[model samples]
Target chain A: MLLTATLSLLLMQQAPSENVDWDAEFGVEEVERDPATGEIPVEPYEQNNENAGAKPFTGDDMAETFGGRDGIRQIAERFVEINFADPRIQGIFAGHDEVRLRRTIFEQFCYILNAGCDYTGRDMKSSHEGLGSRKADLNAIVENLQQAMREQDVPFAAQNRFLSKLAPMSRDVINR
Target chain B: MTPVFNHFATCLMVAPLALLPMSLCAQEVLSDTQSIDQAGTFPEYNAKLLLTNAVSAVDGASGGGISNWATIAGRQETRGVGVQAHVTAVLLPDFFYQSHGVALGIADRIELSYARQNFDTQDVGAALGIGQGYMLNQDVFGAKVRLFGDVVYGNTMVPQVAVGAQYKRSLDGAVASAVGAAHDEGVDVTLSATKLLLSHSVLVNTTARLTKANQNGLLGFGSVSDDSYAIQFEGAVAYQFSRRFVLGTEFRTKPDNLGLGEGDWFDVFAAYAPSDNLTVTAAYADLGSIATFTGQRGAFLQAQVAF
Candidate 1:
């Protein structure tokens, strides 16, 4: 029986299992497919990886530094749009109110930017208590937000300022 | 006595490499490398996660100030490259150790690092006839690559594993020879595993190193009595108190190959990161008998920057 158990353990160790390559699986290629010559594909998350770009914004007040309320609105809109479509994280948003989500996201961003906006959403830890969110899912959302800020032309430093405030929320949002 | 010199020597050798990461961070210009996605976001510091990227140790691999860790260097993943530099100083009662190092994280898969150590023998130098406050120096170049699993978020039982090597050379080879060492240069290889239980906010690392150096190459590589490489074990456990603060303890088992009476080493440490671009670490270490001195206890501090 001991020998049989040992053999079983060895076989279990060698068994094939799911191996998700988070990088390749969640890369930019899938969302930005090319047509015609198919050569001018959009730059993925890697090539444009500058958290603090040239002429980057520098200051403690991120909202005003990033074009004030208008910039936050644009970034929030784009972030919501992308999150709704991102396959990696879209499933978690099912049955939720899109309008409420958008408003919540905007208010949260404003609060982080210290724009004097009040966030009425539930506490992050409690809201995400049973979402079954994983690191991969959270990473996908952060990437989406990054893409949104990039599209809005927010300075890399500005983007980092906003993200830095948001980054800590991971503790509350993941697998609580 | 030899251990004091060894520690001091390794610290100086690591200094220059530590300067590179900060310079890289300061010199970065977005216009030169600006390739934004359709949504206009450029990828930066995309590999691993925040605070997950530890500072380069005295040995030039990512981890605490002294122990080597299993995480890759830098902040980049396969989509980008990351670089970090660090400087560490340990002030002991009998001697001092200073090290500078830089590490590169490639695609979150591999890590390459180099460090130099400088050891100041202080008054102990007079007894050894090397001169008071005599300094010894050595250089270490190292590389590590991830093998399997993920430390932060893997569903499987397999821990994140990495294997690396450090090539060490003593600049003061004459002093090493005088101390009855077999050689002044040697290579130390290590296999390390790390796992993080995110739910518990805990991280654990275990490393096995094959080395021939006495006092981490401060007394040179190998001894006249036993010149063969021996295996050593290192372990660390940390609890994440917040997004930016971690408290931990580390223990390293050493080989008693030389007459220096080298014993195990232990430390209690705290690491804090105010931002992704910077980190600071402080620790209290108990480095058992080195050479003739017993109870080499001291404070350790390290500052690191990465991009």
Candidate 2:
């Protein structure tokens, strides 16, 4: 009697719950019953591996997603246009000679493009000297540049690379 | 007894000299104290905003024109106590000068600064009638209080406003008083505001200052009452091109107090932060002249390190 009770407790622990209807849900076919005992065992389901695979991204795929450099240039041009409209900037470049001013703009773009060409324009001091430019004017220009970059969807990493090159000019640009 | 008395009197006379080294040592101790006091006054932001020293311009805000030259004033983030020392030198088109001094942050609310400016105008020749040339020297003592403002997190309603005053005095008493000028002493006051628009990635800083000083401690004499209370406006914008770098520009308009000239100032600049504690900045700047001078465009380089 003691042994039988111990076996019954062990079997109860290992048995499947009555709430689980495995045969009905999984559509398992009927199995032949043993002559001495009316019991059958069910097999585990097999997994399909044919469709579970990883693939590499190709160059053509990247082009299709980012739309390449041409798309980036268009975005840059729009940025310049919007930034030029700022009133503070309007005051700074207001009377500047068009030819020289255009050159300045072009040079900035060339540098951004990483074309490997010398800016060749006047150094920041010579360009702004005697102009009486102020901190407000500088802020406007920076805002416009940022706006332009944003419109182009330039990656944040690339934008920062450009900014790192530009930040040192502040000392020459203010309180002189 | 008579000789002994004489010896005692002599020792008494030498007592001051005997304590001279102790006094010097005391001064060194005072310097250290001043440094600690200055550091204690800055905002809690100093730990993360360590590069405020070298920039002099403090984010986008101007502390107080020539009177307030440090980037950030007071030591604490909001208010408590602190101290700072700054040295700046600029080589202009026609002149070169150096300015250096110390500032104390009190209650993390008010700040006091003293700076001496030494100017080398080179050769003025017969224009001033003094000699081949003469150098101009002056001292400026200034004070500022954070009336009602803050620049932390994303709060912008307060606008970080400050009011300040500066007193300038010249060393050349005769040259200064001879021109009907008031011994080269005057007071200047300003109201400043700074704000950051994080969504736009821009920082805008503005200042409106009133002054009666002449040549800003340059030129021969100080300001005449007739030209007192000149109004000046300055603004700057900085765009974070990346977490570690920013590009900015500035525009400032000044009063024509020198009777010598009139105009505005502007610049384009860029700043880089190699780490949270160090920042390097450069700019192309244009400063209208003291009087009839023009074409004073130039460049500047600055580095800031904070602890």
Candidate 3:
């Protein structure tokens, strides 16, 4: 009787291991941020400026109007900030790579505004895949971006000018 | 249902003899709301940007105060639906004009609208032997479909284009026949192109309308002498002062089919959106002469709500 009791206690102690996540145990890997770029590495594709989705302005006036590259960077950061905080669309963006978004968004803005930057990110279509975004979600993002631009003192007309460049991307960003 | 809505529906059901081929499927217009997600709450319906859906025109179509555009009413996007309702009044020196109606927008592709207009002849009614304070009522039912392009997106060089038709029925057949009208009902076909030049902060719309309407079908269709349709033009230019404020001017030509000397219409208007759901428009309108009363001008006021 004493031996049987001891064996049962030992079997119960080993039962907890049965619930272990076998997928992880089977060597599934979690993506890690690159030490150099501070962003999770992605499967690579050929990069092109056309991926920016818009042509840059011809003159430097538009760039200057946005307060140069630094201003563009700040605007991008604020835009992402508002997007992440906005409850209406946050669920769609919650799992996004914020570090990568800040840089790529800045690059897209800078390139489009003629502030001189190359976009190294994926195209709008691929980047927004599996996000389950709706038109209302897209509108929320636009509202947030507008708020960010307004905070950066972008003139309303200028803001709309910038918006016109981004508005066309909505078809790609929003789920059909 | 409100009496006004019941009346509007009644008018729609009773007027099946219109000149145009159309369907009666409209019951609402663009809704007023800034962002459906305001206050961090989930929205029941999609909400467009402030004033993006456009205000309710006097005719109940999606437009400014007096001119129709290529915009679809409702705060919904390409996959959602929306509705709006409006009440309007114009106090002319010699007459009083009132209109109310509803419109429905579907999937950003089609818009259906209905409006009832009442033109009180006031003292002019007595002079014309139609009894004092006689009112001329007209019911306008409209449908519009977007042919192609986007008003706020796509290639900036390509404006949004649409085709629409308004089937009008005059309720007072006796008064209309007495005025030498050939028919009590007519149709207006319109093609419109509209664009919002965000870079310039301007909105432009030009519409070509084919009609035989006398004072927008209040006095009825064409006259005994001529009952053919005439092509008229409607042009509007607006400046967006802010997200909620717009100032603009419009010009619309009218056909004097009855020889009532119903001249063209012009207005300088301002539209203000107080919230996502309410927009108020005030304008100085010059309707020219109506019937024989010359110098028909006045203040045009409209209030609209959409959801």
Instruction: Compute each candidate's TM-score over C-alphas.
Output: 0.60, 0.49, 0.84
User: Distance from true position, residue A162, model 3, in Å?
Assistant: 1.4
Q: Which candidate achieves the best TM-score against the true structure?
A: 3
Candidate number with the higher DockQ (2 or 3)? 3
**Highest DockQ, which number?**
3
RMSD per candidate (Å) reads: 20.8, 25.7, 13.6
lDDT of each: 0.73, 0.52, 0.83
The superposed Cα distance between candidate 2 and the true structure at residue B44, in angstroms, equals: 12
- Candidate 1 chain B, run of 10 with poorest lDDT: B23-32
> Which residue ranges in model 2 land beyond 4 Å of their true spot?
A1-176, B1-54, B57-71, B74-80, B106-108, B125-127, B131-133, B173-183, B220-227, B242-244, B273-279, B303-307
Chain A TM-score for candidate 3 is 0.84
For B173-199, candidate 3 gives per-residue lDDT tens digits of 888889999899998998989998887
Residue A164 in candidate 3, Cα distance off native in Å? 2.3
lDDT of 2 by residue, B186-207 (tens): 6667677765444355666777
**Model 3, span A1-176: residue lDDT tens:** 53353334334442335678886889978888999989988789879888888888889988998999988999999999889987777789887899999999999999999988998888888888789887677877888888888888988888888888887886688775
Sort by DockQ, best first: 3, 1, 2
Off by over 4 Å in 1: A1-176, B1-47
